[model samples]
Target: MRVAILASGNGTNFEALTKHFQSGDIPGDEVLLFCNHPDAPVMKRAERLGVPHESFTVKECGGKEKYEQRLLKLLKQYKVDIIALAGYLRVVGPTILNEYPDSILNLHPALLPSYPGLNSIQRAFDDYKKGKIKETGVTVHFIDAHLDHGPIIAQKAVPIKADDTEASLESRVHDTEHVLFPAALKKVILERMNKQ
Candidate 1:
């Protein structure tokens, strides 16, 4: 399977995916790495891994529709089979979601329907402090028009310890994401091949 990764941050998950692909833990290859931020660390990771990388600024595109159009054009140019969102902060528009449907996957730091947006780990910690939340976890799901409301493909819980700080809980959640994301991608690739 040919995969493309979209990221806007430090790219820890991106690094994990590339490491797994390099070590043969995942059968697919990362054909491209695209970043919205020019200085995103994922671009450096892609360079270090010798994978082709591209960048586009949402500002340059003038609007979400035009930006997504450019993105879809690039995905088509590479014949990208799967688009993985790794620390990609933007909510993908309906156009890409409609075109790819279940083919686009996102890795969320916390379990679904709980802490759905940015700073999920911190939000979970706050909720726990207020006695509103009992558990926190990572979720891998397909992308849809709604934010983080797509069908969940995989999830793994990370218990919040009584004395756990936000940073500690976040670390655990990220570790789980690193493990679960690759496994889910591998399964998706295998399932696609089987259907063929």
Candidate 2:
């Protein structure tokens, strides 16, 4: 399977996936790393890992539709079988979703159906502080038109300790995401191959 990664930030998850691929633990090729920000750390990571990287700024595009159209074109050009979003902040428009459907997966820091949007880590911490929730974790799900509403492929809970600060809790969640995302992708890739 050929895979592409889209990220907007530090690309810790991107690095995790790359490591998995390099180790031959994941049964797929990472064809490219695409980012909206040229200065995103993921781009640097990609260079260090010798993975082909590309950047497309939405600011350069005339509209959201055009931006997404270009993105779709790039994905198609690479013949990417799977698309992974790591710390990708922008809402993916319909073009990409309709083009790939369940093929695109996103790693969310907080457990889904709660803290669905930005500041998920901080929000979960706040909820824990209020004694409203007992646990928080990571979720890997297919991307849908509705933000973070896609079918969940996998999720694992991490307990929020009494002494846990937002940073501490986020650290655990990030660790979980790094572990879970690769495992989930490995499953998906194996399942697809089995179907063939």
Candidate 3:
């Protein structure tokens, strides 16, 4: 399936997905990258990986409506079958979500139904420190209009160590994300292919 990744940060998940697709571990086609920040490092990573990427700033686009319209146009131009959000900070508006619906997927750093928004990893770590929970993990889920509240596709837990700090916990969660996101994408793509 054709996949478009939207990221606004380092794009480690984007890199992982590209490598997985290159190795034929995940069946994908015509992968594209999109970022809202003009200077986001993901743009550079996209360049190095030979993936076509586009960026738009709020001021350049005028507003969210026009920005998402341009994004929709690009998605259509590339015939993207799925939209994967990786570290994208902005909340997707109705324009894209309505257009893609269940085809859009996101990888969250915390197991959902608990820590659901920004700084989830740190929140989970804090909760653990307070003895509120023992483990936290990554979740791959379908993206809805709500932030990080969607049907989960896959999840894998990482136990909190007694000596774990926020950074170490974040590292382990990222490792889980790199693995789980691709697997979830593969499953979503395979299901799409089968239904067609």
Candidate 4:
């Protein structure tokens, strides 16, 4: 399987996915790193990892429609079979969603249906601080049009320590995502392949 990672942040998850795929521990070829922000640090990591990369913002492409058209074209160019969103913040429009369908996956920092959308880590930590919740975790799921409201592929609960700050809890959640995302992706793809 050929996979493309769409990311916006520090690219730690992007880096993890690249290494996992390259190591042959996972059964896919990570052929591209697609970034919505041209200057995102993930592009730098992609260069170091020797993975081909492409980037352009929606504004740079004129609008979301045109941007998605270009995005679809690029995916076709790579013959991409999967799109894994690491930290890509933008909502995926219908064009790409219709093209990839269930082939798109996203990693959310909080155990979702509770804290969906942005700032989820902080929200979960706040809930914990208020004694409203005991733990927060990571979730890897198939993304739909709804933000973070997709069908879950995998989830792992990360306990909140009494001494844990938001940063500590966030670090553990991220680590869990790094592991879970790749495994969940591999599982999804393998299942898809077998059904073919």
Best by lDDT: 2
lDDT by residue for model 1 (71-150), tens: 99999999999999999999999878888879999999888977888888998899999999889999999988888888
Give the Cα error of residue 120 in candidate 3, in Å.
0.5
lDDT of 2: 0.91
Alpha carbon deviation, residue 65, candidate 4 (Å): 1.1
> 17-121 in candidate 4: lDDT tens per residue?
888888887786888899998888998999999999999999989999999999999999999998999999889999999999888999998888889888998
On the 0 to 100 scale, the lDDT of residue 63 in model 1 is 85
Q: How accurate is candidate 1 locally (lDDT)?
A: 0.90
Global fold similarity of model 4 (TM-score): 0.97
Predicted candidate 2 versus true structure: per-residue lDDT over 19-128, tens digit per residue: 99999999989999999999988899999999999997887987788889999899999999999998888999888888887899899987898889889889888988
TM-score of each: 0.96, 0.97, 0.97, 0.97
Scanning candidate 2 in windows of ten residues, the lowest lDDT window is 56-65
| Candidate 3: tens digits of C-alpha lDDT, residues 30-50 | 468999887988999999999
Which residue pairs in candidate 3 collide?
none
